[model samples]
Target: MHTYLGTFIGVLMVLTLQRVKIGPWGGTGGHAWDEGGHGASAGGYTGVRRMSIGSSWCVSSMLFEYDDNGKRVKGTLQGERDNGIPEEELDFHGEVLTHMCGYHDNHLIRWLQFRSNRNRTFGPYGNLGEDKAGWTRFEVSMEHSGSIVGFCGRSGNFTDAIGVYVAVWNPERFYDSMRRQGVRVYRASPLRMDLRQIEEEKKKEEVERGRLQKEIKEGRERLLKLRLKLGVDVLQQYQEIVQQLERGREGKRQTIEELQVEHEQLERERGRLRKELDLKRLRESRLEVELNHMQTWWSKITHL
Candidate 1:
């Protein structure tokens, strides 16, 4: 009988696990809703509740139906919670029970949280301890009857926590609904990361980098050519300057030679002027002597 019941519980656990599809068994961060009843009515469920969402089964709330022998008979799943709620609600909210977080896909990305009374800070199946308030809850297992259900143990717990619970919604149904609503779900397997896409991306980046390097080399060559041309022009300008200086020096030498010739001609003219002055003086003296002799002869004749 124990074996049959254990088999039954195993089947139920498998079903619940399939419904919640978080990576393993771990609790997501919990969100405690406002007890004042704002977020509770947003989704048409009364009484604000806390929720935890993650990629593992630990954050999902599990539901079980048990037999009279305290054995689990059946199972159901809830959904995954989101981070949309404020941080103040994190401690009180428990793991969500929903199908949205199951199936390991993003189509149904919603999470689940426990729904209970205002002052009931305990989680699903009384897994809460006295000091476990205000913490995210994770449901490990559950033994259930018609009305009273108790979980095996709390997987995630917090000390001095205000409110917390374990909760989960069915993920398969939520994913179906999302598909009906035209939401696309990528089937990317977390187990197998695609290396092809990564390689393609690397190749593209390499091509682009190669192109950039080629452009840089071409630019450097062009700049070198321009510099060489500028140097050639500077050398030509220096040559022209040297030629002009040489011509200027030659002109100065020619002017100095012409000045020397003028000096010689002026000296010859000065010598000729001195000779003419001497001749004039000689003629004047001879005329004076002849006049004196003529006056003396005229006197003698008169005396006779």
Candidate 2:
């Protein structure tokens, strides 16, 4: 029951994804689309090809179709734009499209990808042209036998786009179709690389990456130390300011204490001055009274 439910969900997802605009052939909605570069006609592709931005060349491919068992059923298309990057001897600007489809295991479909290119001859690095209205040629071969069906390619980019598209139908029928289109279908072995050797090479790469990361970390540490040294200098300057402030406060406190002592001494001197002033006033009054009494007696004796 669970298996059936999962199958239903998968089919629903496929149906939903199919709604997106794609090629009339139900493959990548379009190719080489860059704002004004998106459109389609019933015939083969045309117009001047432009390279992806910033790249010395523009190359892209997509996987548009796959079988229920997860095998590709379409070919691959790659375009290279020349910006004088490759040596100036090779024809660098051209497009290649390859198609190969068959079956290997019950669930695995095998296909070969090939490309066709057309560009000017400039020794090694051919100048790229902006027009796609040029002649091109392609060749490919593959071999397999089983029940297969359909050819479609999904649209995407290097990081976001699918890889390639393929069509895995009956080889006999596909062969005839290719022959008519001037495409030759034949038996051939797919190119392969040694896995164990690749693993050893991967280990070596990991070790080198580790060493680089360690070096970066040490460099960052050195930078941090320099920043810390600057911070310490700033802190010392702040400490000096605080000490100066403390000394200023101490001096102010001493001046305040001295002023307080002088104020008390002035208050005592004022009290002494008031006592001396009262004593002088009393002596002057006594002398004035005695002088008045002597003058009156002398006048009476003179009269007698």
Residue-level lDDT of model 1, residues 1-304, one tens digit each, is 4445434433342233121111232233333111111111111121112332232322333323322222223322233333442221311112212221112112121223333212223332222234433333322221120011112212222111121111113345545644464534322221212243356568989999999999999999999999999999999999999999999999998998998898888888877887787888788778878878888889989999
Q: How close is candidate 2 to the true structure, as a TM-score?
A: 0.32
Candidate 2 global CA lDDT score: 0.35
Misplaced by over 4 Å in model 2 are 1-212, 295-304
In order, the Cα lDDT scores of the candidates are 0.35, 0.35
lDDT of 2 by residue, 104-170 (tens): 1111111122222221211211223444333232323322211112223323332112122222224
lDDT of 1 at 287: 82
TM-scores, all candidates, are 0.31, 0.32
Model 1, CA-based lDDT: 0.35
User: Which window of 10 residues has the lowest lDDT sum in candidate 1?
Assistant: 35-44
